[model samples]
Target: MYALEKPQNFHRGTSFSLITRNGDDRSETSDYTSEDEGTEDYRRGGYHAVRIGDTFKHGRYVVQSKLGWGHFSTVWLAWDTQKSIYVALKVQKSAQHYTEAAMDEITILKQIAEGDPEDKKCVVKLLDHFKHSGPNGQHVCMVFEYLGDNLLTLIKYSDYRGIPLHMVKEICFHILVGLDYLHRQLSIIHTDLKPENILLLSMIDPSKDPRRTGAPLILPSSKSKIVSESEVSKDAKASCSDLTKNQKKKIRKKAKRAARKCIGKEEADQDIEVSSPEASHRDDKSNGEPSEEKSRNSVGENSNNDEANDASEGSRGHKRGSRSARQKLLAEVELKCKLVDFGNACWTYKQFTSDIQTRQYRCPEVILGSKYSTSADMWSLACICFELATGDVLFDPHSGDNYDRDEVALGGRYSRDFFNRFGDLRHIRRLRFWPLNKVLKEKYEFREQDATEMADFLVQILDFVPEKRMTAAQCLNHPWISVGPRQLAPSMSENGGSDKKQETDEREAMEVRVGNMAIDGAKNGKDSKSMASPLKQ
Candidate 1:
């Protein structure tokens, strides 16, 4: 993914194939400290085998740099000659079997775009889509507006410690907003919701388009549009990515000298810079917690030690004082995020698999072989929330899984706790089940009220029966979320004010109920539908 060969198009012993490396900006280039020792073992037709600076679709877009890769495709940060800006190009794996999911994704994205153009409500925007033929085979390609690194990367940049609660709340809130839009407005099921797919929105200033200034940059296939000098440097680094290590160092040195000359400075006094916008791919070997790779080539690690130390202090202080110092930074930065990778997404009207969700996030309904709806997505969100909060999975059943599966480590005995609630699945005696609040208190060290509130919210969504679980809309409206932390929601406030007059009428007219059927039956021999916690009116 990082190379800088001199020839416009030449093969390298280390690089995968012949690349058309053209541009020559290296101010942001880092010296090569790591080697591709095992890259030769990759198959010739593999996704990572593509050369840098490769043009596709009649050279409408020029490959700039490899953004990252996935099991089914490799993504590159490419320059759009047509749009005069950088964009993300995803090339699907050569295998045609993966085509079905890609096509489905395209359809879902288009439908979502058509439904709500303004719904920057928190879903990634698909700018364009097309296909390309390569020696391997015909590969489907997608174009997306270049966005900042994914949440997994950001978490690593912040170190393995849990993020401040305010930032975490905002992130989770944005996720729920996106989920609400998909589940309510589009009726689309994400199927997958993990940190990897949660990406921060664009970092580029949208108000400025670089290509208006005329510049004589010649190319046969590419139709060069005039762009600002700042962006020019960025695109140049992408094209010259195939240069050798010494070549990169020399080029960078010369560029810095030229920059210093322009400003009449004797020397470039800054540390070697990494101009690439993308952060390093997350270190996946840490069981489940995210960690940054400390390899010399990794971006962002060397840029700032003060910020890391500050974050550490801020996190500790926030824990003690109950307010995050970085909350304003998150808001000011407009740190919006969106869900990507609709490859596994399916329409509510169309069903793909009876089994859905990654194993750890799987809801009880699917585990019990019962039919599931969008509520399955809700379950996954609950699991993701727990993971984000505690840096651990909530309900992993396997020892080999990346998330912690042992409940005893979480301070609870799983068998004793769950058997009472789910044991009836085997058609045995139905013991009284433990409440979610009790479980949270036992399994975690959170404050009592905090545990109670979280458990209350989770309990509504984690119902043993699928039909009883809170829907996405219900989740959005839950007091724990909508009420703004510890404050009471206006509608649920004690005063029977005019604002809540209608709500009070409806609620008072509504009959009050309590207890699950099993508990009620055990006490009074009455079979009844359970009433979860009352809405705090």
Candidate 2:
């Protein structure tokens, strides 16, 4: 069954075809499901040159598998043979404009790396970058350390469930630290901040690969369906057998020529699906790690593929569907996450745009066409925190004619209070705030205390005025985000640690003030549910 097969390069770049003869070789082409395709399929419509077994940079990294597709780039899980590790390569489209964008990102990443020496906090690390000439075009590829699932993947995998509170705090804390670093130290703003951009630091102790660990990570939200070693061995052999059979079946020379004629002719450009977790699963089945709904609980689930399944929801849809409004909580507690994408990142003095954030997480100032600073990121952070705590978008405003239609229907449309970013309000004293406490308590069933503190924390940033908004540094110092497990410690000072004691007193007093504030806004509770927070000029 020996046969010769030329490398199936998909990109439009310089070709260095490696033809190899093997006894068995076959590959099935997966239809690019727009949702789960590698990043930016909606931006650039075409086939890329990267393929399974494709080696780059003198065989430093060999492609193991594809991760997902995007409009701007396609991601692949490649093995760093030179370093004896796995890495994710983001292969940009060969288009010049996109290549320019990739270069911008590379410059930003270099700045970030040079700014932070030890990787002290949680942020995706960029490893390497180079250009690869392929069939589609000359692709500028950026390499990243291989990571596990994004937060969205974790949520969807839990049967569309929300995560635990303690875990949420942990995840949010790390995100704030990263955001703080970006906003303060780096003087950069991450224009795109969503679940898809926030990746898990690792499934286990990052150094060890999950595949080599011999144990799969089980989410507390969904009980793990562990497969015995024998079953996994059987499935592996079956998959390999199927691959070899397909590879050995030769494509007629005429068929190959016909296929070449249609390369990059596929139109997969569609609006990114933001709220639906399982919406694109059917469309993505043709690609790697195919799974059906019925076999969803099957054993030997590849975590990397699971990440691909989740990355499609990165569009950051402005509306959380009615079905996803209610979410059951997971039981896991040890959660860690890191912010990843920074393609649109710009300096604080020079922002990319006044409209820098995703629709769902856009701040009031941005929506009102006001000048926004780092406070804009804080607003997005607050929205993300709410989603993490409730498993739903906090301020989802539908698009087109339906935008803010829900609020208008409930007599809660209060856009008149918006300021024009120039300190001129549409109406003074006419603006009303639907207390965040009631939104959390009534809508998501958060405890009174949790709701109060979180509302107090969020309100300070979700303000109409950017000047009134809380900074990332202030957020880190807030009692809600700063508070951790209380423990009895031996007195460092014989005087009963007066400074520590004073700090505790202040924290407790702040907590009391937070509760009082929520109680004061109890009258606004009536409008919390139907009230709309999302508005656009």
Q: What's the lDDT for all of these models? A: 0.48, 0.51
lDDT of 2 at 137: 59
Say which candidate scores most in TM-score: 2
Q: What is the TM-score of each predicted model, taking all chains together?
A: 0.55, 0.60
Residue 318, model 1, lDDT: 15
* Superposition TM-score, candidate 1 onto the true structure: 0.55
Tens-digit lDDT string for candidate 1 (1-537): 111112111111111111111111111131111112124312334342343334566656655444554456666655565555677777776565666767888999998788768866688778888877653556788888766545544444332333434455566677888888898888898876656567667421222111222222211222222222223345446667999988876766666456435322211221212222221112111112111101112111121211111011011011111123232233344457777777778888897876565554666555544567778888777766655544444543422212122211111123343234543211112222434454334333344665577667776776655677788778768866775433422222111111123353452343232123335555775533221111110
| lDDT by residue (tens digit), candidate 2, 1-537 | 101111121111111111111111111222322334532332232435454444566455655556665556767666564465667878777778888878988988988888777986677788999987654557788888777666765555433334545566667778888888888898888866766678775542222343345322111111122222233334445555544554523323333344433221211121112212123233222222211101111111122443342232122212223332322222322366678877767787876555556555665555555566777777778777766666665554432222322222111123443334454433222223335575555434466776677677777766656787778888878877776423213223211111223354664565576456545566556222222323211
- Candidate 2 clash total? 30
